[model samples]
Target chain A: MLEKKTHLNLLYDFYHSLLTDKQRQYMELYYYDDLSLGEIAEEFQVSRQAVYEHLKRAEELLHKYESQLQLVAKYEQRQQLLKRMGAILEESSPDLEELKRLVSALKNVD
Target chain B: MLEKKTHLNLLYDFYHSLLTDKQRQYMELYYYDDLSLGEIAEEFQVSRQAVYEHLKRAEELLHKYESQLQLVAKYEQRQQLLKRMGAILEESSPDLEELKRLVSALKNVD
Candidate 1:
C-alpha cells in the first residue's frame, strides 16, 4: 500500500511537470473560469469525456508532484512564514531585530 | 539571457526535487515556524553561515523547479480552478449540471 502510494506520487509529479499549454488553458477555463464541463467541451469543440480526461490527468500530475517533491507543502510553509513576518512587522515588538534577522534568512530562500 | 534563465530554472527544479529531510526541516522552521537564523543555528548546533547556506541552497532549489517545471504556477492554476468551482456551486446557476460535469472532470485529476 505504501509502495502504491509512492508510485502514485511519482507519477503525479512527472505529470505536473509535463503539462502542455493546452492542458493548462483547459484547466484554467474549467476550474478557475468557472466554466461547466459542457461549456468547456463546447469551447474546445471536444467531447465532455475528452475534457474530463484532461482534467483528470492534470489532477493526477499535481498529486504525483506533491508525493515526490512536496512542492505545494513547501510553498504553503513559506506562505505561513510570510504571514508570521507580516504579523511581527505589524506588532512593532522589541523583537523587531529578530524579525529583521528572520527576514534576511528568508531572503536567502527564493 | 533566456539561456541563463533556463539554466536557473533547471537548477531550481533539480534542487527542489533533491531536498533532504534536514534541509526541508530547516526551511519549515526558519520560514514557516518563524525561527531566527541565530535560533535555528543554535538549534542545529551549527554556524549561522551553515544555516544560511542550507537556506540559500533550498531557495535555489525552489526557483530551479519553477523555472524548469513551473510546479508552483500549475498549483496556483489548480487552486484558482477550485475557487471557481466553489463560486459556481454557491451561485446555484442553471449551469449546475455543467458544474457537476466539471466536478467529475476534476475528480479524474487526482
Candidate 2:
C-alpha cells in the first residue's frame, strides 16, 4: 500500500496538470495534505462515494498517462545517469571516454 | 504553415504514444507520409471531412500535451546544455565548476 502510494505520488507529480481541477484538488488534499476521504468529501460538499469514484478515475488516468508517456521512468533513468556522470566528473582524472558514453546515453534517454 | 508542421512533427514524436492508434495513423499518413486528406480518407473509406477533423483533433491534443508537459522543451534544453558541456569536456582543461553548474541545472530540469 505504501509502495503504491509512493508510485502514485510520483505519477501525480508528473501528470497532475492533465487532470481536471477538481481531481487535482482532491488528490492534493488526500495525498499531500493527508486528508481522509471523508474529510475531502465533506470539504468538497460531495458524498464520500462520489469522492472515491473521482479519485479512482483520476488515478486511472494518471496510470494511463504513465503507461503511454513513461515520463517518470525516463526522468528516473536520467537522474541515475546524471549521478553516475557527476561522480565520474569529480574524479581527479575523469575517464573522458566513459563520460562521453554516459553523455551519449543521456542524450538517448527516452 | 511549414513551421507549424515542423513543430507538430516534433510534438508528435514525443506524444504519439498518448494518441489512439487511428489518430497516430492519420497523423503519420498526413504529416510524415504527406498523404492528402482525400487520399487518407479513401484509404480508410472515410469522408475527407472526417479525416480532417481527426487530424485536427490529434494536432490539438499534441499541442495540449506540449503545453502541459513541456517534455520537448526540456529535451531541447538538455540537448543544448549537453552540447555545450561536451564542447568543454573536449578542451584540455574543462571548467569543472561550470560543468558542475550545468549538471545541477540538468538535475533541476522539469
Candidate 3:
C-alpha cells in the first residue's frame, strides 16, 4: 500500500495535468490528502463506488501515460544521479566554487 | 515558421502520449513525418480543412500540457547542463575515472 502510494504520487507529479478535473480532484484527495473513498464520495456528493471508479480510471490513465512517455522513469534516474553526485561531494572536499557549480548543475536537472 | 515547428516538435515529444489516437496520428504525420495537409487528408480520407483543424487542436492541447507540466522546459535545461559538462570535460584533463563517471551521470540524465 505504501509502495503503491509512492508510485502513484510520482506518477501524479508527472501526469496529473493530463487528467480531467474530477479525476484530478479525486486523486488529490485520495493520494495527497489521504482520504478514503467514502470521504471523497461524500465531499463530491457522489457514491463511494463512483469515487472508486474515478480513481481506478485515473490510475489507468496515469499508467498509460507512464508506459508511453517514461517521464517518471527519466525523473527518477536523474534524481538517482543527483543523489550520487551529492554523495561524491560529501566524500571529497571539492573546491567551494566548483562544488557550487556541481550543485547548480544538479538543480538544473529537475 | 521554423521556430513554431521547433516548439511544436518539443511539445509533441513531451505530451504526444496524452493525445487521442487520431490526434497522435495527425501530429505524427504533420510534425515528425513532415506530411502536407493534403497528403494527410488523402491518407486519412479527410478533407484538407479537417486535417488542419486536427493539427490546430493537437497544437493547442500540446501547449496546454506544456503550460501545466513544463516537462519540455525541464528537459531542455537538463540538456543545457549536460552540454556545459561536456564543454568542461573537453577543456580540463579531469581524471579518467572521474570523467567516465561524469559522462555516465550525464548519460543517465537523458
Candidate 4:
C-alpha cells in the first residue's frame, strides 16, 4: 500500500497539472492532504461513491500520463547521472573517460 | 513561419506519443513529411478543414503539455548542461567550483 502510494505520489508530482480541477482536488485531498474518502465526500457535499470514482479516474489519468510521457523515469535517470558525477568528483583524479562518457550520454538525455 | 514550424517540430518530438494516430499523422505529414494540407486531405480522403483541425488540436496539446510539464524546457537545459560541462572538460584543469555548482544544480533538474 505504501509502495503504491509512493508511486502515485510521484506520478502526481509530475502530471497533476494535466488533471481537471476536481481530479486535482480529489488527489490532493486524498493523497497529500491525507483525507479519507468519506471526509472528502462530506466536505464536497457529494456521495462517497462519487468521490471514489473521481479519485479512481484521476489516479488512472496519472498512470496514463506517466506511461505515455515517462517523465518520472527520465527524472530518475537524471538523478542517477548527478550521483554518478558526484562519485567521479570524489576520486583522487576525476575519471576522465567516465566523465566524458557521462557527458556524451547526458547530451542525449533531453 | 519557419520559427513556428521549428518550435512545433521540436514539441512534436517530445510529445508525439501522446497524440492520437490522426493527430500524429497530420503532424508528420505537415511538418516532417512536408505535405500540404490539401495533399494530406487527399491522401487520407478527408477534407482540408478536417486535417487542419487535427493539426491545430494536436499543436495546442503539444503546447499545453510543454507549458505544464516543461519537458522541452528541461531537455534544453540538459543540453546546455552538457555544453557547459564540455567547456569545462576542455580546460587543462576543470574549474572545481564551477563543476560542483553544476552537479548541485543538476540534482534539481528533474
Native contact recovery (fnat) for each candidate is 0.09, 0.62, 0.24, 0.74
The lDDT-based order of candidates, best leading, equals: 2, 4, 3, 1
Looking at model 3 chain A, which ten-residue stretch has the lowest summed lDDT?
A91-100
How many clashes in each candidate? Answer: 15, 0, 0, 0
Comparing 2 with 4 on DockQ, the higher-scoring candidate is 4
For residue A25, what is the lDDT in candidate 3? 91
Model 3: how far residue B95 lies from native, Å: 13
Estimated TM-score for each candidate: 0.43, 0.95, 0.74, 0.95
Residues A3-95 of candidate 1: C-alpha lDDT, one tens digit per residue: 755544445444544576777777778655779989999988999999999888887667756677665555555456555545554553324
Error of 3 at A46 (Å): 2.3
Deviation in Å, model 4, residue B36 alpha carbon: 1.1
Name the DockQ score for candidate 1.
0.05
Model 4 TM-score?
A: 0.95
Give all candidates' CA lDDT scores: 0.61, 0.90, 0.77, 0.87
Off by over 4 Å in 1: A1-18, A100-110, B1-66, B69-110
- Ordered by DockQ, highest first, the candidates read 4, 2, 3, 1
| Cα RMSDs, all models | 18.1, 1.6, 6.1, 1.5
Candidate 2 local lDDT, B2-108, one digit each (tens): 98787787899899998999999999998888999999999999999999999999989999999999988988999988888888888898787888788888888
Badly placed stretches (over 4 Å) of model 4 are none
Candidate 1: tens digits of C-alpha lDDT, residues B15-78: 5455778778887787657799999999989999999999888876677566766554554444
CA displacement after TM-score superposition, residue A76 of candidate 3 (Å)? 1.2
Q: What lDDT tens digits, residue by residue, belong to model 4 across residues A1-110?
A: 59989988889999998999999998899988899999999999999999999999998998888888888888888788889988898788888678878888777766
Which stretches of candidate 3 lie above 4 Å from their native place?
A93-110, B93-110
Candidate 2 — which pairs collide?
Answer: none
